[model samples]
Each structure stands twice: as C-alpha cells, then as structure tokens.
Target: MKKLMNFKGLLLSGMMMLGMTAFAQDGASTTENYDQGFRLGFGLNGGVTTGDYFNFALGGDVRLQYDLSQRTSLTLTTGYTHLFGEDNVPDLGYIPAKAGFKAFVWGDRFYVLGEAGAGFAVTNDYNETTFLWAPGIGYANDVIDLSLRYEGANDFKTDQVALRIAYGFKL
Candidate 1:
C-alpha cells in the first residue's frame, strides 16, 4: 500500500517534469526553426528470459519522445510484459512505466538507449512492485525502428532480453 503510493507519486512527479520541460522548449522555439518537434512510437517485442521462474516473455510498448537536440531525445515508455512460467509455477505479469534518454552514436540512425523506472507486477497470490531498467542499442528511421534490449527488475523473480520492432511516424 505504502510502496504503491510512493510509486504513484514518483510517476506523477516525473510526468510533471517532462511536461514542464516540453512547455519550456516550446516557448523558447519558433515553429519555423523545427521540422517536427516530437514523435510518438509504438513497438512490439518478444524474447526469452533467463531467471528463476520463467524463460519466455513477450511485451509491447508505446513511447513518447521529444527531441532535445539533433542527436539526442527524451523518451518515456509504458508497456505490458507477460512471463511464462515453468512447471508448477504460476505465470507472472508486469506493467512497466519508464523514462530515459536515447542518443544517436553513429548518426541520426543508430542510437544507444537507457531507461529506469518501475514495474507493477501481478502475481497469483499477491501484487508487487519493483524497480525496472533497460539498456540497449537501436536503429531508427522514419518508418521503422529496431532495437535489442536487456530488461530487468529488482525485487522481481525474472528478467528478459528482448528484440523490439516498431513503426514510427511524425506527429
């Protein structure tokens, strides 16, 4: 209960900060100087987990990104992941909400990404919340984005490495 409340508060605060940043950026810039300011992306990922209770996991996510510079962007992600259980173990699931930064390394097309946040887990007997993070590399263009990421959570029983594919367009 208390942990859940704290998590909610943190989530709210992060969102507020992002909103304030975006507002400030918008105020400081003119429409003619920027081509397209921000983008929204949706992605699907599937991968294998190597951990105590589960081995297979599948997930999908939506992302909102704002360009901070030509080579860097701020990203926020919300996703759902389902972990398949081993024999005699119940299946587990998570709703992950995260915020992070992505930076292009080799041009506008290749980038490295890192994010840290929390996951709300649903279990058979009880619900739990855990810290979550992912770090990876990716390629992106106007139509498609591809990435491989290792995602994990603290205080949860499992983890995953996923290859994600997404379609993105300007908004």
Candidate 2:
C-alpha cells in the first residue's frame, strides 16, 4: 500500500508539471499584434429551441470583454431572445444577463467559453425568472466573433442551441 501511494503521488506531480508547462507555452500567452485592454461587441443570434412550445428563436446581444492574456478573457453579456411559436401559441421573450470566461484551447482564434446568470421572462405568460447557463465554442479576432452554444434556463426548462455572429472593436 505504501509503495502504491508513493507511485500515485509521483505520477500526479508529474502530470501537473507537464500541464503547467504546456499552458505557459500556449499561443495566447501574451496580448500582442492586436488591440488589447478592453473590447465591446454586438452580436446577432438565432437558434432552434426544444419543441415544447416554441421552435425558433432570435436575439441580439452586447458583450464586453477584458483580456487577461491573449487567450483568456473575462466577459459580461446581456441579451434578449424572442421565441417564435406555432399558430395559436403566443410568442415568448427572455432577457439574459450573464458573466463568464473564455479560454483559448487551440490558438488565439479558437476558444471555449462558459457563462451563467439570470433569465427574466419578459412576458407575464411565463413570469418565472430562471437561472441561465451557456457553454460554447467560438472563433474570434479583433473585428469578428462567431460562436455556437447551448443556452439553458433552469426553472422554465427552456433551452436552445444557438449561433452567434458578431462584430467588435477595442474600447
């Protein structure tokens, strides 16, 4: 047992060291060749939702980002989603306010992101305010941003897979 424990510790330590080294050597270690400090972007989003009541969704959003490194950023996002329903069903709308982070995985242009916040129902027909969460993969540059994501709300059980296309500049 003692020998096994020692082996496990050694293996864990080696793995951690390797991970740190790789992280430090990533392509996004520094903010260079592009504008930095802060940025703001405007996005148009469209998607397909769970077919419970609504089938399609469209939205607009604004995002503010601060780059901690060339490949890592903290972000604030707010958006409105309008759901289109079937005949006889009323359209529904939601406003979301979320805070999240983006991390580059392959290079400065490709990344994964996560965000969580609140979704407020804009119409009284669905007056529940729910927790909202999104996880996504994206490509971004100083001028353009594009992402595909799954956005979900807890209490209302509303969720969608969305594509967001955006334009941005430094602030």
Candidate 3:
C-alpha cells in the first residue's frame, strides 16, 4: 500500500510538471510589435447572457492603448451595451472607463489581457455604479479583431461572458 501511494504521488507530480512546461512554452511566443506607441481601435459585439435573466445584448467600444514595453501595455476602454427585453428589465446601458494590463503572444495579433475599471449608469432610472474586471483572449489582424472574455461586476455579484468583434485601423 505504501509503495502504491508513493508511485501515485510521483505520477501526479510528473503530470503537473509537464503541464507547467507546456504553459511556459506557450507563453514564450510573446513578442513586441509597434510597442511604445499609441494605438486606437473600435469594435462592436453582441451576445446573450444567462443567470438573473436570459437576455440578449449588443455593445460597442472604443479603446486607446499605450504599449509600455514588449510584454506589457496599458489600455483605456469606454463602451456601452444595450440588453434586450427579459423579465421587464428595461434595456440596460452603461458607460465604462477601464484601465488594465495586456500580455501578448504570437506577436501583437494574439494576447491575454485583464483589466479593472469603474462604470456609471447613464440612464436616469439606472443610477447604479459598479466595478468591472475581465480576462480575455484576443486576436487581431490588420483589418479586424475579436475577443472572448468573462466580465464580472461587483454591484450585482453578476458575471457574463462577452464576445467582442471590431473592425478598425491599426494606427
């Protein structure tokens, strides 16, 4: 029994080490492109959510990014989303101002990013304020970009999955 347990532990440790190595290798592909410069882009995305209510939403966002280094950047995002009818929860909207860090791999076109920021309600009926945070995987080409993210808000203890797609110039 003792030998069997020892062998199991060793096997688990070996698998863990292998997984770590794979992740590190994937992380090594990150490279710099157009770093230390300013980039502005805009995009639109629509999706559905489930939880408090099953609803559909569409949103547009604009972002300005400043690359502080090859592996790091700071971004500011402002955006609004409109949720469709569900449970009489009139279409909801928000304007979010966020700042976060981004890390890139496979050049500037693919990345892993996370950001935290605050948002305020724009409509009179929805004077609620909330903090937002998201971690996403993104891909961009010369003409188009897309991202998948999970967004969380503190006020409602709510979380949603977001899919964003945009077309913008890389200047």
| Number of the top-ranking candidate, with lDDT as the measure | 2
TM-score of each: 0.78, 0.79, 0.73
List the candidate numbers ranked by lDDT, top first. 2, 1, 3
Model 1 residue 143 lDDT? 80
lDDT of 1 at 131: 91
Candidate 1 — which residues are off by over 4 angstroms? Answer: 1-36
Q: For residues 70-156, could you state the per-residue lDDT of candidate 2 as single tens digits?
A: 767899999899888778878889899999988776656877777889988897488878898787778888799999877876676
Off by over 4 Å in 2: 1-36
How many backbone clashes does every candidate have? 0, 0, 0
Q: Which 10-residue window in model 1 sums to the lowest lDDT?
A: 22-31
**Among all windows of ten consecutive residues in candidate 3, which has the lowest summed lDDT?**
14-23
Model 1, TM vs. native:
0.78
Error of 2 at 29 (Å): 4.6
What value does the lDDT take at residue 101 in candidate 3?
69
Q: Between candidates 2 and 3, name the one with more favorable lDDT.
A: 2
Which RMSD does model 3 reach against the true structure?
Answer: 9.0
Query: Which ranking of candidates, highest TM-score first?
Result: 2, 1, 3
> lDDT of all predictions, in order shown?
0.77, 0.79, 0.67
Pick by lDDT: 1 or 3, better one: 1
lDDT for 98 in candidate 3 is: 86
Estimate, for each residue in 61-162, the C-alpha lDDT of model 3 and write its tens digit.
Answer: 998878777655688888886656577666567787888766665555676677789877676477788997766768876667788766666673344667
